[model samples]
Target: MKVESAIAQRISRDALISILLYVAPIALMFTTFYLTGYKPWQGSNELPFKAPGFLEDVFRNLSSWGLAAIVLGVGVIEFAVGLYENKWTKNERTLDIVCFVVPKLVVKPFVAYFGLQLMPYLLPAAKNIFEWVPFWWAFLIIAVADDLTQYWYHRIHHQLPWLWRFHRTHHSAPYMGMAMAGRQNIIYTIFFSQTYLTVALTYLGLGYAALFVKVVKSLITTGAHSSIPWDKPFYEIKWLNPIGWVLERLISTPATHYAHHADTADDGIGNYKGNFGNMFFVWDLIFGTGIITRKYPTSFGIKHYQEEEWYAQFLWPVFKSKKEGSELAANGPMVGDAVPETETVTLKQETANVAVA
Candidate 1:
């Protein structure tokens, strides 16, 4: 019995060490950022990066509609390729359109107005405190803070059963495209923590820089969700392998993001539990939640989904699923451990798949 106890202790120690290995990169990133005095939550003493007057004017004139145009253009290309013709179901289409329209037209404007109103009251003297930070520095700070906060928000929704319902609509589609990226519950969109963070940063006088960051972020995220696999050629060419490696690590590509939308991870290329990064894949890398395979998943979406009504999927809690036993059902258990059973089974099955690969 004593020998068995010692063996168990050794195993536990080894497991803990293994976990730390995965987490070390994330810890290092946070440490480096903090040490560099790039705190997004605090005011900086350095002068902000000055841009050419014309360039600043261009950014200042950019509107939210411009960002929408970029996303819409991508959607048009996807449609031209008939990407969604056969893949998207009626329910998926409804959820995607409703989720896409409602957030941009109503929820986001409401949230932004509320945030703008509440900011001065909450932090009256703190307004424009970060105006002294340089443009490049402020951009770096906003990019990281905005994306990192979103990474956690997305990861947490997947990790917790109750929160999973709020995000389920996103993964319900069996295929991915730019449209699928907007397929989220209304509550999820409205309560997105990063939105408020972005609003606060804008209030701190980083509005122009924040606008630029938002546009860049939108491009990265939309491209990542695209079915085009634009990064595929980079992975295939021997000469571009180094660039591909760096690119994949730096931002979300179709391969990594599709893994997050994969139906199951048993295939070795699918990792629905990880790769929660939106614009930046670095967060996933740092937090030990990323899986990189320069390869896309063969299948996407949650397994055994009962195809709940679009309304229930879009406006859940306000409109519960009528389907019995569904997570979004009126009387269903919210925080139950039942969901992980499938994940456990998938992991066990993945061992054989990995060996075969």
Candidate 2:
């Protein structure tokens, strides 16, 4: 009886600490983006947050509501699934908040500040190139370019060892949910947000290509992390195949990204190369990343990782393991001389042939 009471107390304390840590960053973000003059433009020529009619304008506007719906929906669905599936114990969520949320919150503001404020002044020529474009074209171009950059970076995360230790936390969800989607290391977020935002800001007026991808990435990521497996029908729809083939070619698909999260190394499935894609699978298709699984992975998460406490997941660079070969995201550990066999047959791509997604 005493032990049970003590355990409960500890869990409660941990959860409290985690809550404060997670809430701080998001609250700050809401304050920052909203307080800044980043409000929506009223003109028709302006992009992002268009109101269908005047009355629809009431209820704090559809755009803000839409964003809230997406975020809350993802969180509710993820935590709900986690609760039901027992895939993530309460402790796991602790690690997730720390590992995924805190770092991003801290990192994003500074990145946004620099990208929006400081960087532009340094590159006036880039600024001119940026300002010279119409919104729609800029939107389209930025959308394509950002995804193109992400494709390579995501692929490298899978291929690299030390980096995978952190990035792989994202894929560590045993089952999917909206929250699971955001579960990643601060280092991964920094690398991604920094690079993507840098490229993104270079083309700021690209309308919502910048915002669209962020929103789309949010939706798709939540959907991808969802245990519901929307990919089944997406793959089964005969008509969707052609359209999907086009979309998946240009962006990541649930099937492809899910395989990246598959539990077993050789899950007898699609590409487990740990290469994640979103918004554009074309990068993979163009860069030899296209995998024709058509099936979501049966098993998900690292093949040989131990479940670390949640704090390690977020505060990895800090308060996490750095021991060589530790089972918990152990990097640089010798996995014996046996190299795992890969069933994937790599086909070389010819640069001469251009495939548009």
Candidate 3:
């Protein structure tokens, strides 16, 4: 329950809260949903009212229990990753909980709800999106579209300072594993601000396309942030690599994302929050902000990684920093000034990990 050095520096807490916060609810939810056969109320206005009754049946799924199971499983993986990781100087076990819980609990669901409510208005386009594709296509479209939305919003976090202030909470974790992926500002829910892509697709009238994309976002983003690293081998297979490389470039991958958390641009400019993409790396490549590293960070977090307090970390945009030199107060999300010059600071030999090997 106690983090060794974290107690000394007071940078991270010894509280075992993340283990409980991240795990307990997921475990309970999974148990409750699976044993009780409970599913979330899975739809809203996204279905085209004019569709053949069969089409309605095609997309209308009972509320889902699968997400609870999946989220809990990932939560366990994150906990296990934290226990096994011996390298963290900041003792970020507790921080991991905050990172995972805040965004996943407060943000992702709200965004999903907004997207769902929008389904009604978008039902017309939602129907059209599927005119050419089959049911399975619905899955792919959902996955791609959801990630696509995340890709741009995530990218904005790094490019703009105000957004980065919220995002910095995610990056500030000194150690990362699968759980780290969820670490972020709750206000990130705001990024779900309706987009042209969603609107366009909604108008296209895709059945359950919106719903499917929501499911995929939770899974893919969770996987990319996980310590699993299964993608490396998958990427090695010539066929798989192309798919992964293509998707990774097209959507955010751990390779690109973890690099964004890296301390050095020479290694790669990670913490500046610039290399943002969720499900696709291609967004970065297309936008000219991509960095592909074969290696991961020995250390994580911004060089001068400073946040005022936990309250400040959570209610960020509203809670102005009482301290100085924070990335937020100096300007805001859009300002690029928070990024610091690194020559003055040097990484410990061990701190700088293998980059792009």
Compose the digit string of candidate 3's lDDT tens values, residues 125-180.
44454334333444554554455456556655654444566677777766556656
Off-target runs (Cα >4 Å) in candidate 2 are 1-45, 48-86, 103-106, 120-129, 194-204, 237-241, 265-267, 322-357
Full ranking by TM-score: 1, 2, 3
Give one digit per residue, the lDDT tens place, for model 2 in 1-357: 685476456545544653554455445544554788542343323443554564234212212233233333444444555433345678666766555345444455345434445545666555424443435544555555566556656765665454666675676577666556667777677777423463335334442345555556656656666667676765788877777666555555677777667765465564666345666565455445457676777776654455665666665757555443443443545232113222111111333244431
Per-residue lDDT of candidate 1, residues 149-168 (tens digit): 68767876876566888888
The residue-level lDDT of candidate 2 at 149 comes to 56
For model 3, the stretches where C-alpha displacement exceeds 4 angstroms are 1-99, 106-133, 136-144, 193-207, 234-251, 268-274, 328-338, 341-357
Q: How many clashing residue pairs, candidate 1?
A: 4
Among these predictions, the greatest lDDT belongs to 1
Q: What's model 3's overall lDDT?
A: 0.53
Model 2 TM: 0.64
lDDT score, candidate 3, position 217:
62
Error of 3 at 312 (Å): 0.9
Candidate 3: 10-residue stretch with minimal lDDT: 9-18
